[model samples]
Target: MTKNNAQKKAARLHQAANRGTPFPSAMRAVDTRLPAAVPGTPWFRERKRRLVCYCCGHPNLIASFGDEREDTARFELYCENSGCDAREIAVIALSGNMIGTSSRADVRTLTHFPQSATSHRTVNGRYDDWLAGSEPWVRTQRGEDFPCLWCGEMDSRLSQNDVATDRSRFHLRCLNTSCVVREYAVLIVRDGTLGTADRPDVMAIQYIDTPPSSRRTPGDASYDFVAMQRVLDEDDKLARRRSTGPIDWSAATRIR
Candidate 1:
């Protein structure tokens, strides 16, 4: 499908998730946070391009803390620009793809009244379980036989089948969210770097599956030799550029 078509379908899926919900709370529980990338992931060792911040144009904004969930590592990227209080969370599979909203560009506001606790919307879950239960809601792959993923029960409301990604390819969902998997973030990674808006180096990359890749041709096997060499040549380049130091941009006044 064309980019425009994909976007429209994604919006519908989001709507369906909310409209046909048997469990709104569960949906919230599932789709909230962004996971991080770590050593165990497939791409971590491969050395793709550095993950730059799409929001404020900051490069390598990720901070990784060894959380308990080995399968699902959590990565938090906060834009500490004086007035730009945008932040994002991401979840990375052991295999190395950024699943769900971690792949999204539009950000959630880091909650704090000029200076307070930034309300994080990120939710964490066991990686394997999440991966196994929630298969990609692809029409070509799994959409033919399965009913609507959102409701799990086909109501008259979910008569049509149109899927889309958001304005950016950050997330994809049913034109209407039924109840479950339709409204979800598409796994967006390209050339080893996590893809985001306006970043051509990684944009338009094929969606790489977190688990075993099904496509025989060009699975998650591609990498940028130039970028990889940079990783080896300047081992501390990324580390020095993206320090996980405590971020306290609270003092930076917000401009209306």
Candidate 2:
């Protein structure tokens, strides 16, 4: 979608999340004090080119952070797609001696936000278990059937078909009429010398047909490597720029 469309969708999603009139329980639990990204911040730049929504595959997302603690900080990322309920919370563990002394570059750890008693939406089991259950399947050989990641009941119904990457390929689709993710998810396999002589290292990249984030020239991979590389470059530059300065928590919420 265009930038204008993305902005409109973000407004709609925000309204939907904050609706407290008819369905109070439906309203999302968002912290008002969360720090929004400033114009030149790394988070702001990440929102522009990367961070695709897991549900609707939209690029319009909101990135925010909570107050930094002694050795950790929390980040909240949510899609702005009005129809999507995709959001993720990640905790970054800081390295070094002093509190808030380390920059983003100094942080090398990522973990899930601790679950609260009131929130049933957080992962139900161990973080590793949740990842194993939710992540898309990666295949190197044949005979393995790809399942529908979105359809809980009809998970194993979708059969493996071809959608080619380097050498091998596979396609998966949920036949369930009521399933939200009815689109075909293609797993592009990378073959040849990437792996051992017997098996090749296949990278399964999900390609949905409907969303703006999935729009690409025909035959292109799900990711735009060049664009992603540029984003990484920008992140490195931003990290370097912020390395010497102390984080101004009070100034974080201000948007220019």
Candidate 3:
């Protein structure tokens, strides 16, 4: 097929899949390219907003199409959750060159988009420096403002800022309200002198991941009685087996 025909076919396939239709061929693949950077301003620091899964709250969503071009960008994304088939389309307009800035963004998502899916967690290039041990790292005092990895907002605050007992290590958290995901980074000072234990010249930085949140959708309140009945039946069988005081290991065989 021609390039234009392939693009049209991909769009048709996407629409059919959204409508719960089976694909004509399992070998067919969508003619889409992965975006090199997050959709937003041209600056890397401005790419702060991420498309999250609305149904499962997954951080990574696969982009179907839409390249960030001109002052406006459109993103077509699908959930990474195997059990959930949530798809979303978002359009972002850059007002003053950055997203999730101090003035916020003029971005807009689909009406069905849940608030939980709008995450401000974005890591642009800071992590690369952490790995390369780049020089002139951020130096800060306790409770002061620092560059945030997630929101990229200028008004980000640093807390839990204190030097460790080792005198060479320090730690702090990005308490920026604009960012949904909390950021905690470990730092080490080359001078090994944490004067007054307040200010530290960070030489090396390490990013720490936050705890995983619940994947269950907030809107799903109703339980599947049929699935629940199956679970109860399984529990009863397990209870009967436990009544023997221990599981019979000799009879246990791996199922292929």
Q: What are the clashing pairs of model 3?
A: none
lDDT, candidate 2, 19-97, per-residue tens? 6312111121232332443222222233333344332335544453321111122233444555433333222222222
Which 10-residue span in candidate 3 carries the lowest summed lDDT? 203-212
Give the Å error, residue 30, model 1: 28
Better of 1 and 2 by lDDT: 2
Off by over 4 Å in 1: 1-39, 42-50, 64-69, 80-83, 92-169, 172-256
lDDT (Cα, 0-100) at 104 in candidate 1: 24
Stretches off by above 4 angstroms in model 3 are 1-140, 165-169, 187-256
- Which ranking of candidates, highest TM-score first? 3, 2, 1
Return the clash pairs for model 2, or none: none
lDDT of 1 by residue, 70-131 (tens): 22222323333332223333322111123332232211111111111112222224431111
For all predictions, the C-alpha RMSD in Å is 23.4, 22.0, 20.7
For all predicted structures, in order, the TM-scores are 0.21, 0.22, 0.22
How accurate locally, in lDDT, is each candidate? 0.27, 0.29, 0.30
